[model samples]
Target: MCAMKYGLLFFVTLMATNLVSEADGDLMSMIDYRYFRCVMKREWKCPDSEINFFMYTPEHPRKHFIDPRYPKLLHDFGWDPMRKNVLIIHGFNGTYSKSPMTFIRDAYLSRKDYNVFMVDWSELTRFPCYLSALSNMKKAAQCTAQLYSAITQAGALAKMITCVGHSLGAHICGMISNHLTEKQYKIVGLDPGRPLVSAYGSRQFRLGRDDAHVVHVLHTNAGFLGESGLVGHADFCFNGGQKQPGCKGHIMRIARCSHFMSSCYFAASVRRSRRLVGIPCDTSCPKERGYWGINPQRRAVVLGDDVPDGSRGMFCISFENTEDCPFD
Candidate 1:
């Protein structure tokens, strides 16, 4: 088991190191990595991760999964068609019960009367074998699309549905949006994973700006787990999207803590409480000017899942490392 795990890790390590190797002054193409990917794909055969959806409402705070096949399951569960729906997708090794996921879910439920559903695919996204989990994201997204389809057919409004994903789960939501012919109301990517994904430009595998009618990305750990590229209509970076506040000591601890802050900041944003403010810009702002500076006039977009539309391009907001309040 150790050998198998390390073997997979070796391939990932090699590809990551040589992400942009040069041959005769020419950038070596992705074909070089394809061989190892093929081997992993064929040998592993990609796990068909089951996508589970749990719905929550103010009346009944307990999370429950409603089967779309029954159509009436949602109605029976006290789902209000009038209320807008938001589906939450968790990242690698995450589940419905986890911190960021549950925190974000409860935060939304605490303030709004919207239908909140948490999408769990933790079985396939177990830790240590991220390669397998990354490949399985597509299958999981397809399953989610089918599930969403069923739900919408059952009287849920597709036009009113908003899907939010954190880490690799963000990419999964992107894939789900890509798979469906109809664009979802909105897709919010909270720090989309960078490793094994940042190198690729394929719209099929990675999230893109056009995946949904309105795609917003919050980069709390950008250039690390979060892709640094501007891949959304509005990409908001809090504290430059790395080395987040309250994450101190040790490299790994800092990275992990900062990476997860995207969700925490987002959860707080839903209630519009002490939200990090961003200023709109016709063109992208210089890195030094935004996020790092505490200019209220420069505020672009409020940090969270509920950003109002109108502005485009990247935005930034600053906060101290010890400050729990986003902009304070």
Candidate 2:
């Protein structure tokens, strides 16, 4: 059994490394050597030590590490109970500092309206350890839930908070509800990881429509790195949700770019709400121009941060070219 376990580990590592090679060049440049050391050291069992909560507010733009164990520290760090809170979680092979997830963090900070808290569990979800990262997700979620409780105990309302996550982090956002007495008010899942998650993950372990009061999912690489079909109350598929027009090069590279684009699109939405709009379409992207016109009766739905809480069903948005889409 031990030999089989090690062999499986070797296989997963090899496969993940090959997969990472196909990612966008920009994503490749962001890989921190520390993640390699963490993966090599087999730091998969995410204890309390592996998870951290860093709070950022307009008053204190710099990150202030807040321990979930000390809920009162929130007050000490200039956390304003009056402002809405947003918890941002990064995905596999991601660090709070370098990953594309930082786009969303900065967008929220620029608005100066939210008390932003970024959950950094990079040590637990390092690269080339996809299986281990998946294993660590529940512990990470449980730890994040403590932070949620800490924020609430510090006088923030649960209804005024939003949980935003990318890829595996998206599922972590959903799983956070498992440890809480009540569900979160909102959750925006950016291209929730597909791999083992879509095929094997249970509802409790994956992002689902019922995970939050309003769950919005942006699919930029569906059927590949991102989850396909209707996975949330509001699902937006950009450029057919397969290959983003803005991405060029090999198919895998495009897929990676597309996967990362989910966060980019979302961040843009936060900065300019209601700017990106989608029309009601089938589960997939509309085939022709006539298809888009066929649904004149259905009102076009806004995508991204300003998506109406009541919006439901699959929506599709097509861009004439890369310039038309906000994929920065």
For 88-110, candidate 1 gives per-residue lDDT tens digits of 99887577677767877888888
Best by TM-score: 2
Flag regions of model 2 displaced more than 4 Å: 1-13, 20-47, 285-294, 320-328
How well does candidate 2 match the true structure in TM-score terms?
0.85
- The digit string of per-residue lDDT tens for model 2 on 138-186 reads 8889889988998899899988899999989999999999989998999
Model 1, residue 66: what's the lDDT?
63
TM for every model, in the order presented, reads: 0.80, 0.85
